[model samples]
Target: MDKRLIVVLVVFLFVLWYALRTAQIPPASIQASAEVFYINNETVTIVEKDGWGLFTLEVKPRISGFTFEIEFPEGTEYLIKVNGKEYRGNTTFKTTIDKDSEIYINFRLPDEDTKKLYRGEGQYYLTIKASKLPIWYVEYKIKLIPRKEKD
Candidate 1:
């Protein structure tokens, strides 16, 4: 075989191998349970059913806050608890299930003075209690990346 042809073939094979290796699905950090579906390394959705109907809970971490999206049967009631405290404040919002019913909980990096008290990066737990549905719970891992300062 010609030298140039051989070189091109080898390069093409390496590229193909790299693509296949990286395209593989990431192993689930949390195994699938009775009601929880581990979507990926950073997302999980919980599905439960009761007399009221089907309900779903999706949890994902964002740069500054955590996105808590949920879908419950109409007229159903639910409560959210963050780190053991009831989250019944302005940060929570109510919307229809057909729409993107998302509740964003904003958090900030602890400043130098308050770093010891509220060290920003770590895992946070959330417990959601829904009417006529099994209690849904999840732990969200958060990592804070510093923003680049623009000149």
Candidate 2:
């Protein structure tokens, strides 16, 4: 190759390297304050049900991965739309209490998906859309390690 051509190629390579290096993802975010949800009363059930402990919601998931809990006024109803799809779990339970006697309708998915609440294993972005508006959007970037038993 000619000397001038070699210099131009080196400059192009340097520029390309710089651009790629700067194309990094923003820094990880801070874990916000305890998550509480306020949903339109029309669609959420924030009440106690059956004989369950604080029925409304419960997800103290097993497997040390991640825990997400949401507390809202009683009489709140929510649909579990995980990653834009419906999931099968206690997430469909109804809240039968009023705000005056309010308790949390919490949902916990332990270990990302130790039990496969919604999506498969590994990192995930869980979103909660209340009523007709997009409310309480959350992302849980977690690693789902397999559970083991020790004898």
Candidate 3:
């Protein structure tokens, strides 16, 4: 065997090993459910009108994408937060649902711009707080879907 060929093979194997070891695997789909609670005031126990939901994921270090699908009543006002930070994307996070809409929001995993963003091998939280729901409603749900990185 040629000496140069052996050296090239060894380097290739090392690179492959490193890539495999550092690659991030996308998480599975998650469904989060939430229920309303009560607040005790001085005079009475008030039922909280707001609905809350939480979706948590331990993201790995990688440049991936995610989709959050949320459904609620037409008149509901909602807010979404990621790792305690408010998501400011207007297209993804709608503050109010004036009309009926099928919401689909996309975000990057292991965010590269901000270290504090959802871009590390740690537990990340995605929370939703909605208000002005129908009086009969008492539960809320949110779904998280992982998407593969495009080539």
- For every model shown, what is its TM-score relative to the native structure? 0.23, 0.20, 0.25
Q: How accurate locally, in lDDT, is each candidate?
A: 0.32, 0.31, 0.33
lDDT of 1 by residue, 1-151 (tens): 6999999999999998777654522111222222333334543332111211112333232112222333322222445433333443222233222222233333222233123223333322223322111222233332222222359
Best by TM-score: 3
Give the C-alpha miss distance for residue 119 in model 1, angstroms. Answer: 50
Candidate 2 wrongly placed segments (more than 4 Å): 25-151
Which residue pairs collide, candidate 3?
110-119, 111-119
Candidates ranked by TM-score, best first?
A: 3, 1, 2
Indicate whether candidate 1 or candidate 3 has the larger TM-score.
3
Candidate 2 C-alpha lDDT tens digits along 1-151: 6999999999999998777555532122222222323334222221212211122222322222232333322332334432233333443332221112222323343332434422233332223221211122233222212223358
lDDT of 2 at 124: 23
Taking all chains together, the TM-score of candidate 1 against the true structure is: 0.23
Provide backbone clash counts, one per model: 0, 12, 2
Native-vs-model 1 lDDT?
A: 0.32
